[model samples]
Target: MVDLLKPYLDLRDAEVETDFGIDDPVVYGSRAAIESIFTNLIVNSLRAFAQDYSSGRLESAEVCFRKIIIRTKKLGDRVIITFSDSGPGIREISIDDIWIVGRSTTPKGSGLGLCIVRDTVEDMGGAIRAEAHGELGGAEFTIELPLRN
Candidate 1:
């Protein structure tokens, strides 16, 4: 799967960071569905933060920022992965309908990003949630999948 996202990581205008807490992991869970989840979140983050890069704001030494962060860790019997962005805090006002199929707030593509994300996670017997990006100032997605025995 790393082959798919390698190009995105090299974008001169993008800044990404990842941290994994599970080192030399046990075979606790399969990361199959994670690809879709990561793709959707990363695409959204790129779109959201593109403005800063294109507008030349990212080069300013005054403000240091990371456009995206992905992290995974094991907690008890579950594996949690989080994707966060530094765009605009999730449009909570629009979130009521965010997951509805074909509901795209932006005029870009079919607004099925979150919908697909939710479905993929649930199909794996996992759960996902959306929230304010907290200090990151954009959106945060947290997914918790049960560890496969």
Candidate 2:
């Protein structure tokens, strides 16, 4: 799945810098669920960044990948995945309302992506959170799932 979405994530010409910290990959969960989670996050990130660029807020005054980082790690008995983007952070006013059903700041209406993310994570006995990217000046999502043995 990552291979298929690699191109879409490429920002520096045709190259993408990815970091996977899972020393030993394990098959502990449904592959379809994992793929869906990543697909939604990545696609949404792309859309948000594009919107920010169109709004003329980027430092370059044009769309450019200053940086985007995807990191994964296995610690003790859990797997953690973090997706960070380098676009304008989520508007302050929409932060609390982002995950609420039918509360979308975008024109599309009925914002439910993050709500679904929360549900899926809970269903999988995992956890997820969204926060400001700090120095990255965007939003970051962290997903943690038990490393089933």
| CA lDDT scores, all candidates in order | 0.70, 0.70
Give the Å error, residue 131, model 2.
0.8
* Per-model TM-score on C-alpha atoms: 0.78, 0.81
Per-residue lDDT of candidate 2, residues 8-51 (tens digit): 76743222346898854563567777877877776667767766
* Clash pairs, model 1 backbone: none
Clashes of 2: 0
Residue 119 in model 1: shift from native, Å? 0.3
Q: For model 2, what is the error of residue 79's alpha carbon versus the real structure, in angstroms, after optimal superposition? A: 0.8
Cα shift from native, residue 88, model 1 (Å): 1.3
Model 1 lDDT tens row, 20-139: 886533333346666777788788767656544555646655234646777889999888888887776555346567677777534464768888888888887788887755447778
Off by over 4 Å in 1: 1-3, 24-32, 51-66
Error of 1 at 131 (Å): 0.9
Backbone collision count in every prediction?
A: 0, 0
Where is the poorest 10-residue window by lDDT in model 2?
9-18
